[model samples]
Target: MKGLVIGGGVAGLRAALDIANAGFDIYLVERDYSIGGRSAQITKSYPDLTNIKDVLKPLMEEVYNHERITLLTNSEVLGLEGEAGNFKVKIEKKPRYVPDGESCEKCIEVCPVEIPNEFNERLDKRKAIFVPFSYAIPDGCVIDETNCLHFKDGSCSRCKEVCDGINFDQKAETIEIDVGSVVVATGFDPFDPNLRPELAYDKYDGVITSLELERILDEDGPTGGKIIINGKEPKSVVFAHCIGSRDKKVENPYCSRICCMYTAKEAYMLREKLPNAEISACYIDMRAFGKGCEEFYEEVQKKQVLYRRGVAAEVYSNGVNLVLRAEDTLLSEPYESAADMIVLAVGVEPKEGSSELAENLGIKMDEYGFFVEKNMYDPVETEKEGIFLAGCCQGPKDITDSILQGGAAAAKAIGLMGRHSN
Candidate 1:
């Protein structure tokens, strides 16, 4: 029996690997031009601050090369029918106009159109014909139809002229596959800090979100991992925690499990990169709940990173620094900290179209829009039989938990198909 994994993030990749290794045919569908998902955007994982790409790239290569797995990047699930052990899935495969061979610099040099790179949180621009990242799977250029000159007015075909690989006529294709079970690992969207105007995320150039900081810290990111604000290295960096999570103002009352840990990790990274810079982590509560998390927090504390118990009230840009206003709960007093930069510790939210996808799949979502599990005792199982969820698509979780759930979902899918003997 075959299995359909919706998403190509860590959880989906893990599930696909497990099922494919068990000798079952697996169809992994990803909505982006490449897989890897948000995890790929992360520079490092928490607790150990391990290089995320070092750990993930090999798994991605395995999935891409696995014989039992049919990896479909730039694809989406159009429709699904039937039940366990015999489900027909219709997928819409979008095109990446660049040809099959490795993407080269020739096409990029000729492409005149430039647009903000979404992968880099729009911190930088990229050519219309560009690879999503240096380590992008399929390792090819994808045309941004929305921004391509040829698509706009048929004005420029410079990329096509320079590179024989360009195919402007590439069209979307639909494919049907029969699978025994479905694993929804669609993942989560970073809480948009723009929603909280008080944070001044977009209003000020010095203010950025945690995810944006992740990209900025990445060696391959827009700034090549330099912690620069307005063309200058930040002398002081302030982290504002819980911008989305545990905030009744935004209707997201649940704790986004990773924010506290990731914020700490970011603080540690900042300390390492800017040894003499002042750094403070303003938080409501220190939730170092995971293994080695508390120790990591302690390490950051030992680095002289300040941990302040408070909720940031507002942030305004000064001529030279961003003034952060907040109340220290422990001190029972209000104070303002001036910083060269501010990073909002934004929370994770359900991915866009999650509610609609849940409806389409005949599943349920929690009030917060996360896919509801069968029960608290069995979190991976959805109310719908033969359907499972892994990663933030189900709830806010760390990468380790997401991978564990992926494996659990794979086991459930295998049992549902009665393939234990295989």
Candidate 2:
């Protein structure tokens, strides 16, 4: 049996490795130029203290070495046809704009445009021809066709000219493949803060999302681990939870599982960095439902991290510092405070293309946009016989949960392969 997994993230990679090891040929497709997914964007993971790459690298290495797995990057599943066991897939592969002959990242330096790098979440910019991040598993350069001058107009093919004619101008290509099974592990997107007008996302300089905060704390991130606000050092900090989630009236109603833990992690992280600084968490209710979660919350509170149980009605700027006016429902009083920084514990939503792909493939999607499947007997199996779901593509799940689900999906696929061979 042959299988295709539609993501290169932790879950997809894990599933690919598992299926390949079971003697089934596997094809792992990653939309991005690299395969780390959102997991690669993080620093050290909480509770385990494992570096993001440390957990991912070994599996990535296995995927690289595995003869049965075909990994494709900057490629997308344009369309899907046929039934579970015998499926025809059409994929669109974006041109790399660079020849495989002795490639180097020098093409990035020659290009002058600096676009808001998605890997850095606009905290930094990358040249048009550049890798997503430093540790991109392949650590190779990718051409941002949308941003490249050549793609913009044929006149300025600086990347091609500077390459000493080693550059290839092959047009973006599409190809078709056949697989017996498929696994959908496409991940989720963070709820855009711009959707919340009350928070004034674009207007505030100090306010950012948990993801932006991660970049700030990361050694490779924008600030280089300094909690600097608009290039100035400010004292107090506030983390607001449920920005665009857990609300039936406004944004998404579902509780984003990772927010509570990440919020606690941020509080602890901030306190560790600036011991004397004031750090507060404004939340409706703290949910720590993991092995060491409650204890970790205790540790944060014990370290003088203020856990305010309430919702911020509005956030506005008073003068130099951003003012947050929130009622501490626990205390039954209106409280206003100022902070150097504010981090919104944003929620994750399905990736942009998931629903469209589901329809094209005749799969189903839940109202929330995550792929819906026959989860009763085996949670990961999809409505289609050989298709499986894993990672945030199924729903909002943490990294550990994603990894575990990836393994389970692989087992399901392999079990099917085993039965088919018999």
Candidate 3:
């Protein structure tokens, strides 16, 4: 039996690995130049401050080297035909322009065009020919056609001059594959804080999102792990939680489960980096439900991280620093605080094309647009036979739950394929 897994994040990686280790052929398709997805962007994880790349890079290597698993990066499933135990999937593979087995640095060093690095949340710039991140698996460079000088006007060929790996003539390829089962593991997108103008996300220089802070804390990120804003270390930092989740104005009423814990984790990280700096996290509710989560929250509190029960009403510049006005629900009073940096703990939502993808897969979506599972008890199974789900595509969840669901989805796929053969 053969299986196909869509989306190459942690969830899809685990699902594909499980099926391959069981001696079945599996194809893992990713819509990016490389895998890793949002998890790779995180500097450290909550509950335990394990380095994000330490865990992700090793898994990525295993998947890339696995013989039974076919890694299809820069690809997406265009359409699906047939039913359970017999399926034909059409895929569109985008061109990366970098040749296989060529040194990526050779092309990158010669490329002169610079643009905002999306991987760093636009905190820095990168050459037109570059890898998504330092630890990108398959260890190669990908050309950005949109910004590459050669593609824009056919004027510059410096990258190609130094590297024989450049393939300007590469075109998008269409592929067809046969599989017995399919798993959809496309992850969620971080909520855009600009939707909440009260936070002053893009309007202020010091205002940034929690995801952007993750990159700042990362050693390979924009600032090389320095927590600085406007060329100096911040003396005061304020974290505001539930920027998108549980907010009716944006129409996202569901709780983004990871934000609370991640904000606490960021607070602790700040305490370590800036021991004397004042740190506060404004939150509506402290949902530390995961195992060891409450203990970690207490640890941050001991480090002098103030936990305020409130929501920030507005943020604005005050010449010297940014002023955050919020209501202290516990004290039943208004409070105004000053901070050099304000971090918005934005929530997660379904990826952009989720609705269209659900329709193509012949599945249903909830009111908020997350794929609906076959039944609440069967969280991994989709409404259609032989179709399964894992990770945030089903709903907002943490890394632990996503990995567990990935394994469960793989089990279901294997069992169904076995029964079909019988």
Q: What's the residue-level lDDT of 185 in candidate 3?
A: 94
Segments of candidate 1 deviating more than 4 angstroms: 419-422
> 1 or 2: which has the higher lDDT?
1
Q: Give the best candidate by lDDT.
A: 3
What stretches of model 2 exceed 4 Å from their correct place? 99-103, 165-168
Clashes counted in candidate 1 amount to 0
Write down the lDDT of every candidate, Cα atoms only.
Answer: 0.90, 0.83, 0.91
- Better model by TM-score, 2 or 3? 3
lDDT tens digits by residue: candidate 1, 343-379: 9998999999887788767889999999999998988
lDDT, candidate 3, equals: 0.91
Ranking by TM-score: 3, 1, 2
lDDT of 2 by residue, 185-212 (tens): 9999999988877886788989888998
Q: Against the hidden reference, what TM-scores do the models get?
A: 0.98, 0.96, 0.98
Work out candidate 2's RMSD over C-alphas: 1.6
On lDDT, the stronger of 1 and 3 is 3
Q: Which stretches of candidate 3 lie over 4 Å from their true place?
A: none
lDDT of 2: 0.83
TM-score preference between candidates 1 and 2, better one: 1
